[model samples]
Target: MSTSSHHRPRDLRLDFFRGLGMFIIFVAHVPENSWTLWIPARFGFSDATEIFVFCSGMASAIAFGAAFRRHGWWIGFARTAFRVWQVYWAHIALFMVTVALLLVFDRINPSVEYTERLYVIPFFEDTASAFLGLMTLTYVPNYFDILPMYLVILAMMPFVIALARISEAVALAGIGILWLFATSGYLNLPAEPWSDREWFFNPFAWQLVFFTGFAFMSGWLKPPPVNRWLIGLAIAILVVTVPFAHRWGWQNAEWIFEARDLVWGGLEKTDFGVLRYVHFLALAYVAWVAAGEGGRRLAGGGAWGRFVAITRKVGQQSLAIFLTGMVLAQVMGMVLDLIGRNMLTWALVNLSGFLILIATAYGVAWFKSQPWRKPSAAEASGSRSGAQGRAEPVSRRSELAAGE
Candidate 1:
């Protein structure tokens, strides 16, 4: 195991999973003045949100588990809560920066297109309100986005982490119930009405995959010692389900759409439809198996390995890198819109945008490595104590009042 893994360092596989998720995000969200849609759909890998959110739960479990083990729940919970808040603020800053950029550009050069206008209005107007609503759990913004769910996970982290520590079965059961209810639409989450998002991710429905990942870390779901037969079975299942899903009438099931739209049927972008879930799990299995067997050779370790190494670094500082990627992707889209390209030019621009996004993430990761001064003894002790204080369970009344 890597030294970082000893400290219960972040999972490299999880980082790789998140990196893969961002690639799908680019595919789904990248502006389409031309083609590039059919291929993502044909493979049934287009909708990336479900996979991303599922992985988030798993990553949270691993990260918090390490913290919980090292320092009691109080310190562990405090650190996790603080990190979530950091991500929240980072998201807010990203939203504001994009809005500010769009507004400035609009003033300099007005346009007939609604894309930039749509983007700008969300940040300056309703999106501002939406952020506020999210903090209170009263509203969710961008039904297609993960911010709301992310915040909810943050709020519930104490209970969730505690449960994971006690019994993996209990955690799995809790997630399963949430998944069942959300997918069934049994529990209606009153998101903001104006958004009218066809449910990008009903957390209740997707929790199964997430918690299953947690099980993986807790020794509950070990990769069955990779037998050739099992590998064959997994691949066979994928081959059978994917094409069957595409051809059979099952692809467009209403039960799944009712729960969430992205993955139920065909390869739609945002909603968490059933087919999408199948495809995500299939890919995840393949990745896991490959990694288990020194497939590190396939990914490379020379210059290319160095590059993958960079991704791991960015993975280490994921919160900062993710926000940077989002902002950069949006900015790149705006630039392309301004260029007013022909078909060939548009294709090249799209490709360029994708490369730039990847490169920028690499750059941010590289930058984060610079050495910094260590905290003094007293400062470190005080910081540690503060974290412990936050971790301590508050009175039931305090928890209730905070929620209110």
Candidate 2:
């Protein structure tokens, strides 16, 4: 790695985006109630998942950048593998706790076949498929695990980092081709196979966004000369696409939100649809511009910071907070089902889900700060990286056991 490869440690903009992504993820999944439904698609924006995936990719770049620079590629691989394992165990623990709670409640009083669809039936159906998936670290159908894509990005980090070093232009060109395929569904790529499974995200397609974020951190895609035209172009794209999206949903095939049926023509998450991609890219651009000017100030040292600080906390402890929110949401849905809430009631109750998310994030942040475990590897790496140089710091990779 070139000393020229050496750059700043942490980028506040990336943190801002991660926090923003978490907030969007919260809103998108909260529920379709009155408080939210009326918010309008334009305001509601693209599916938040795109931003999350992109940010994760950017994080991989930053995290793996240092490791690749210091240790060899093997160390980076070992560390990434460990992080993948961490995410998997975290996911499994969440699943077990959720099933136990639901089962305990159901045992208190018998329940129906569906009973909230807590776990995927197929996960237990065949030992071969399930075992293969687990061993390969593949996604478990349509639950809330983002680990699969993150892991894939981690695996690809060396390529991305090497490309970043070789030529920023070459890396960006590769990203462009991937984006075209993801957006248009043109090519049957390595990441998004023709399998009928519903992935949380297809890493092949998502790599475009992720690598783009990496480039951003690597100074390949710095905020374009901020001008009236650039801002105008971004806004125009959103204005034109928003209503069109309403007329024809991103994936007409995904009429019922069936993950397998979704077919995206653009940057959509359903298939990495185009509108979703552009919308998120636009938002990202805006964030970048704002961060460049000043930290995208959610708040300062006063009362406002105290308030926005909650969101920042959520951003900081994203993974733990995300898993907690998923479990809580599922539990809440089960409770609502038991109460026999009508559609209207169910929607209203969804707000509680968002509240639960914020509360969980805040709570988890507080808990992690206690004197038990040391600060997360990501956090510690972040602190050290910041001491290194000027550019923004991306998320850190998990540490690996030696001799992997």
Maximum-TM-score candidate: 1
lDDT of each: 0.58, 0.59
For model 1, what is the alpha-carbon lDDT of residue 307? 59
lDDT string, candidate 1, 229-327, tens digits: 867876775665554344232456665434444433443333344555667666666666776543343366689676566555545555554565566
RMSD of 2: 12.1
Count the clashes in each prediction: 14, 18
TM-scores, in order shown?
Answer: 0.72, 0.71
The TM-score that candidate 2 achieves is 0.71
lDDT of 2 by residue, 1-404 (tens): 00122333244445555766675555444323233343334352465566667667666666766676679777876777788778767866765575566566566546643324644444456556764665455535455446566666666766766666689787788777765765565543221122545565666677776776666655676546778888888777766555445534434535423432343444256456655667877766665555545454543678866655665666667787667666665565556556656766665566666566678777776787784577788899998877664333321222232323
Cα error, residue 339 of model 1, in Å, equals: 2.4
